[model samples]
Target: MALEGLRQRLTDLPQGRFGVAVSGGSDSMALLHVAAETLAPARLCAVTVDHRLRPEAADEAQMVARFAEGLGVSHDVLSWADGPFARETSGNLSERAREARYRLMADWARERGVVGVLLGHTADDVAETFVMRLGRRAGLKGLAAMAPVTHFHGVPFHRPALDERRAALRGHLSGAGLHWIEDPSNRDPRYDRTRARDALRHLSAAGLDPDDIAAAATHLRAAEIGLQHLLSDWATRHARTHRGANLIDAPALFDLPSDPALRVLGGALRHVTGVAHPPRAADLSRLLAALRSGDTRATLHGCLVTRDRTGIAVLREPAMAEASVPVPLGATWDDRWIVIGPGESGMSVKAVGAAGLSQLGNWREAGLPRAQAMSGPGVWRGETLIAAPELLPDGPFASKFARDDFPAWLASH
Candidate 1:
């Protein structure tokens, strides 16, 4: 079927307003065009986020607005005023951009009261994602790829074309008398996804098709779902969640079927606490062992999870207030007489270089720079570089710390 297939998908969606994220590229533009036509988006809006990374990015956003305007759809072009970087060269630029783009669209949807946000991930993309996750030692859950409809940050993400093939979308665009821009980055070797795309094309040419791959993913997803159902029952029988703790019977987890044991408990832990993906295999095993062992505590995701006689308690790391409470020679204390500088009335501070800072403990992984106190009360925000004591204040970015007798704790969240 054609993206003519999309007409049925659009018909089933609620009649309420929706926003499409259009980047002026073929995939997204095709979605914007078809969705606007079917949804009669005279009330719908197109949000174009200009990352300003490309020289033509602003122009591309403008083009998307023009396209929406021609369709009588509302349009807005949002640009970054100040962000991580105008052009970040770090390791995961595309991933970071994807995160930023979704966050921007969700915020826009909330403001405009849009019911959902349409995305343009097609069938081929889903197949590629399945294969890529397989390469990364993924289980069935990861191989299932993106869901067709997922709610995030108060907005629903709709990939109405998850069921539509890529060539079909192009054909539909041609049939609708519309053409869209192609991004050259897709062929760039600098990105790993391009290599994966080429590999998938190679595999497909050798006789694999989208339906075959999608079917495999569907099977995997089903198996995982059944396993999850079983594990949910197991957890209910043996696990307990309390105000500040969760008591999962470690022995019971060991007794459950292995796959369900890992996937279910891992997912439960993530949901109960604000955690990212599951820990690595070794970390997870060690953490489980610590729970049964005599260890006092083990930290995970900035909090401590400890095993007690009855259950496990997860708590925030207590402040290290007693450590170096008095001012040392070269540390800071809430921006007051932190270093060996001429003190100003309202708390003066000075700066020290890399040499002045030393390893206070094995907390470098804590994300805060470690420094020794040489002079006043040493202060920091959750191991972050807040202010040294008025007696000793020396560290990089130390000069910027300000002190107000208004009480620094008052201004804190």
Candidate 2:
């Protein structure tokens, strides 16, 4: 059954080399085994991320490596050895660890030119996530649970076992005479996921079975898709990007229902700041309220929202601005703009601040507000500002904002 499901998923993916993340757990082991059988030996690889959070993590990674070797698949173990929980200053150790793990795996995949990385998230994991998000009062997107295929930092992630049960994967492994390691963290109870797992047992007794919960998540995903379509249509009609900033037609955005309006604004802010997640709900609410009240200016999420005679503009906040840094030709700047440098050496790019804005010879001719112009990219040669992309027609250098197609951007993280 697991093999059949995986075969169907792989069939829909592009024809190329693929990789799986295995941690010697039952679900991941089953996925690696099934993938090895489904794809040619040359097309399959495995990666194990040893977060170094526990004493036994290295041994577990080696065990996974040996198993992959037995299957005639190439395997590599990636380590996070720089002080375990070193970046957990915010008190969310698990969240930090998960983010680090994905970053490591995505970097590895990109370096190896793999098409996508497979995960072993199961139906039981999806159900647990739904319950966990509900406990935290997550909004619709969070309660919708995980998608079968999603992208992180442009790396494709595929969860082929999202429709299968954890017990079923373990049973398949047992029948094949294979043994899997049990991670102690799953039963530690200190993590929210562990607690949610315990709660699911009780909820299952009350007729709220994991399958039922997962089915509900699937329905919510459909609704989320509908909402995204609406957002894309609205953005196409009302949102405009210029000079590395986003401008939304105030009246059209204000006329939208609160939910869709918030989503649009949230997405715009994220795009400008190049942040993956949206700002806090309360922060979004406050900004929306101020916008609706005709407030002139507000700031959040490393972005500044300003209202003028034309429309509401979302630009990078001058306070959180990026400092001048030497940029190589064709390098990305401020995570949003790509710097197109002159062939000359020692060129640098930085935000055009008030001082730099005054030196622009055609600031008024560009028709951008002073504040917005200050946020645009400025190319410098030593102490002199040679070109401001927004203010100049065609200079020695230019910066282009990375634009996304509305529909595709709406669907992604």
**Among all candidates shown, the one with the greatest TM-score:** 2
Which stretches in model 2 have alpha-carbon errors above 4 Å? 77-88, 318-335, 338-408, 411-413
Candidate No. with top lDDT = 2
For candidate 1, write residues 297-374 as lDDT tens digits: 666533455665545544322232132233333443222233443333333232222322342333233333222122
lDDT of 1: 0.59
* lDDT of model 2 at position 130: 96
Candidate lDDT values, in order: 0.59, 0.81
**C-alpha lDDT of residue 360 in model 1:** 38
